[model samples]
Target: MDCEKQTTEYKSLLKIRTGDKGFKDLSVTCVALANAQGGRIFIGYDDKKKAPLPEQHVTPDEVNEAVTKLRSLCFNVGLVASEICTDDTGSQYFIVSVSPSMHSVATTSDGRIYIRVADKCEPVRSEDLQRLGEEKGAYQWELVRTKYLLDGVALDALRQLANDIRKSSRVRQHVKQMDDVELAENYHLVDEGYLTNLGVLWLGTAKQRSSICYPATVQYIVYDVLERKVRKEEWHDNRLNPKELLLDIEQKAVELTYSYEFPNGLFRKQIRHYHPKLVRELLVNALAHKSYTISSDIMIKVFSDRLEISNPGGLPLGITKDNILHAKHRRNPNMIELLSALEMMEGEGSGYDLIYELNAMEAKNPPMIESSYNEVTVIQNAEIIDTELLPLLDFVLQNYQLTQKAFTAFGIIAREKKVFSTRLSAILQLQEEDRLRSYTDKLLKDNIIGRNGAKKGTQFFVNPQLIKNAKVNLKTTLKTVEPYVLRTLIMEDLRAHPKSKISEIGGRLPEIDLQELRKMIYSMVDVELITEGARTDRRYALK
Candidate 1:
């Protein structure tokens, strides 16, 4: 039998001589493989390569009996088996491949649950199981019943929340006429006479907040990095009311700001270390999505140059850091709905988008998001030191029509003063330099940027006239600037890449049509400035 070492996708078991215990063990291993990414398991083969020993081969009948028993296990895990086959030495083995479960965790026949951790299978712990349940949306802490009774809910708190909701522009006018009980029902905070966990979190009395098993709180810390210790004022508050908790955090953050002034003639503009609106959006996310089942408090760390906020939960179900900008998954849907109705949360999933745009407009580094087993932390850098290009970026974001990539390329050149066209491609992390012209050429034709040097040493500099508000007319025909400029652009392409195809050259000048590109190439060949290789393997190069 062909064999390979055990890995995430492969495992081997020596169960040819099977018994009850061996079959149960094999069943548990199959459950784990199904929970994780699907993998193949070999039954009569040694985990490690071995010298041919007398094969303890099992008959097909025995393997078929084990497969029959596995079919009736706790969960219908996707499994397929290979027919028994003999090796060169007459040693027989069979393999079973388990596919990953789409939406459920697999379990053994006797009700034991396990998941693959590295190369081994381990039993799922209670906390991890709860997390998995949450991931599957099988359990919602907010929807769970709380011990607090309806009479125990604070009347004043409910009135205040009702008034707050009524004042929000997003809320319906009819909500203003509903009584406290009706209001709670409208928000899914109450079912029958029982106040759910969601109800207690929002409208519970002060006494009710103290009786919860795991109280929701925020821990605020301002660190002095040079001293390597928490600053003078550090505190923790257990505020069960999400609205009040958000307000308190915002007040605390106000103390952390420092301002600078930019003077222009008789007028002056004030800039804070970080934008308050952006900070509030981040706070709303941490408060609305934190796991209520965990005992941990939301953490806020303010440093000299950056601010970090973390909550006691990784990303919501189906959301990862790579897709955070476009993916919307809220762990506490109840809380998120309430917050959105109150106008506290902006459009769904727009927080990260706002953060990215704010950073780009300010010419600041983009925020960083990191996740671990039980937490997600976002670090926002506070410095806005790109004084020269800050105004330009602001204007571009506010007035210019540019795609995301094009805007990014514009920002890079405006900040760096001058860079090779390839450098912009590198900054964008694109593998091919040709894709960059789709962005840079727009700025070039508008005269917002001008080229310097020649060939491979070429550098692009942002035009000072553009910074001075000089209007650009980009509709002029290429015949006005085509002869010298187009030829130089092609020569620059050849100098950077000695042997490039015509299609690649066209990619670098996306503004020019394919027919126009062919005419230009032939015209350059006529002038002996460039040459095309044989038709069978067509490529262009500087003559």
Candidate 2:
């Protein structure tokens, strides 16, 4: 029986017999599926033909044996669901479903761990295994008990926290009624008479916290026009507490604004460079998720165009750069709990959703979270959102529930007025046209955008009706072709040729100045839109 040629979904297998090879193969596939979104593995069916194979039927006894062997091989794997079905021709088949694991990485008998990438199982590297261990909270430093006793906890910090909790609308009535010790205990900040690391970090005196949790402090820096640090500050003392630390950071943060007066002089509009709520949310997350075990301090760097906050530890277990918006895990659960109770943060795992929503509404680029083995850095761009299309963007976000990729794609179109499929694909970091087409299709289907030209020449633009409904003058809003529009033209040329020399590309786009073409090509290469070839070749291609 032929297996499915493509690795899109379900795995196909022949009849499972009484053999080690079959069991081993089944075990490996199970690990792969479990590491990813769970999928079905069919025994005694041909996935390529989408039919039951008469010769591939497995007996009831063999199915039971297979399940036993698979479970034994993948003992560490969480849930393995199985079922048997009979076709019209009385051909029986077994279907094993492997559910994704939340904590442990699944391993086969030989001790090799695997994760599903595309349609194949790839071995999990040592680095990835370490990261997986982190995601699972296998080493939660914040949960560890410290030598410091509860008596060392600051009374003033406790009183301030309780007061804030009482005033917060998010806190429950019972929580508001609880005393400091009761509240701390409820959140697992105390173990016996000793305060956990969380308690020390939250309530210890400035000198006590600095001595005990030295690395848990934050370092703030502001860079000048030349990128040299012009100012620096530290928050090692515990006198401020976490709540006051947030307040202090806000006070130190620079808030700049741009204003425009209406033609009639009746009103004015002002836009702030950064949002205070966003700053607070970022600071809270850093404090709540940093690895207290690490010796490095959390750092917040402010530049002219962006705000970057880096925590000592990487993303919490179960969260990846790609899945952070949809995934939630707590590296410092106790800290998160107390902060949430005090209404310092939104504990519903919707923090990123709101960040993205605010970015969309403002027409600003969404904040980017990058992770390494030792740290997670978040960069929030300060570019003002384009005011012309703000209404259209806000309308779409309010009315439609779109995927992150789709939302980003919409933003690109809104900002550029029109964008080529290739440029859009490049900007979205999507390698496949088919995958990008799915998102573009949604925009087209909803009539939020319209496609101009076709195939490689395809340009996505906001639907005129959408702009009209948004109450913008169509004539004033009409997109004018810019010099950067030539970038799309060049991308289209590369799509057909794959690789081309400057002269050849120049011949294709003769309207563009030779020097301008060179500048655009070099700029594209710098941004990784195009790859440079050898000196002899001196060619460019889409990457």
Query: What are the lDDT scores of the predictions, listed in order?
Result: 0.69, 0.70
Q: For candidate 1, which ten residues in a row score worst on lDDT?
A: 471-480
Candidate 1: lDDT over CA atoms? 0.69
Clashing pairs in 2: 135-317, 206-238
Residue 54's lDDT in candidate 2? 70
lDDT of 1 by residue, 99-178 (tens): 76646778888788886655677798987887667655787888877766676445667778888888888877788688
TM-score of each: 0.62, 0.59
